[model samples]
Target: MPVAPAPPAAPAYADPQGSLRASDADRDRIADILAEALAEGRLDAEEHAERVEAVYRAKTVGELEPIVRDLPAAPGRTAAAPRPEPVPAAYGPEDVEGNADQLLAVFSSTTRKGRWRVARRTNAFAVFGNIEIDLTEAIFAQPLTTINATSIFGNIEVRVPENISLRGTGTGILGNFEVTSLEGVDPQAPLVVVNGYALCGNVEARPKRGKWVVDLQSKIRKHLGH
Candidate 1:
């Protein structure tokens, strides 16, 4: 797929609700293809619905980051070069639909502003961008998932579900997180937690009971200048 030039600083279109239209076609193409899988019987009805929810409703790549980050590595897709800098300039979709077993993946970046949400879900999806999501209805996810994200000067509020295994968490100082259920971390998973200046976010996880084998934390220092 070809990358489109970033849209104007401010868009000219508006939806029926009278707000600016933040998204366009390129964002939905991958999701549309994922949706088509339903007719081909490659995805079960439930799977089809999940994928649809992930692709259509998710507003930006960040909000949808947890939506779809695991795609089967395209035959020609190369491995992402190891990042040598403390904060790699981006959180690119090195693995967009990069793995098969991993059902969903969302890829996006924020150079401006936008709004997105979950429309439907079928198989899985991929989200990437800088955007915000309002919690009106509900959002669901598959068993195994990966959401690689980066927010330069924006925000991402993820409404998580009950059952699922999370393996990775990474963030930068420029980013701030307000997770509601900090204990939601699935203990069955070998949770790899990492952050810079995350705030307010909490987790309510049903961690499998066991001996005290995992515990970790770190104090964050503020940057003197923006």
Candidate 2:
């Protein structure tokens, strides 16, 4: 029998807490390593973008591994940020932006339950929350926006403007859905909807690019009460 091609080795992911011990300099060294890979074409631009984002988000060499998996090694890669020694400490959700590496953001609020605006940034982002979420303006600011949510457990709702494309994944379990500015959409850029068991809750997702993957396993038939 013929042998199959080897799979792409998974890169090492830095430890989640490695960020606390790493100085800005240390962070840059990590970034430089991957930047070299992107420039060499070992990894795609989107892959490179995610890797760069992870470096700032990462706190340990283990966390860096996944980021390191895709890039090609270059003969010479220079530093854009300084290198610092590693140290260890605790971390909080709000303290995330301080490492000079902010890939994802988390905002938890539950007061009046009013509409909230999604801030615009050049990077890729997603908003998953209850009914107190709105991003009509963000759709305009960013050409691409995504909403990955679970509504049955919590109310994750969002309003988007026209022009930008949208896609989705859901069990349609609770009232989880994605809305666009209009009904007419390009065949190439079709809106998607998914429901695994149509249970009580759902995991919804909509991204600017790339397809969503589902890997769920459960004995749902046994619970159907047949």
Candidate 1: where are CA atoms >4 Å away?
1-130, 133-141, 162-168, 178-226
CA lDDT, candidate 1, residue 193: 17
lDDT, residue 65, model 1? 33
Candidate 2: where is the Cα deviation over 4 Å? 1-61, 65-77, 80-132, 139-152, 159-199, 203-226
C-alpha lDDT (0 to 100) for residue 192 of candidate 2 = 19
lDDT of all predictions:
0.31, 0.35
lDDT of 2: 0.35
* Candidate 1 TM-score, C-alpha based: 0.24
Which lDDT value does model 2 have at 103?
Answer: 26
The clash number for model 1 is: 60
Q: Ten consecutive residues with minimal summed lDDT in candidate 2? A: 211-220
Q: Residue 181 in model 1: shift from native, Å?
A: 5.8
lDDT of 2 by residue, 77-178 (tens): 344555432211110122223222112223443221123323222121223323333332221211122233434334333333232234333355454444
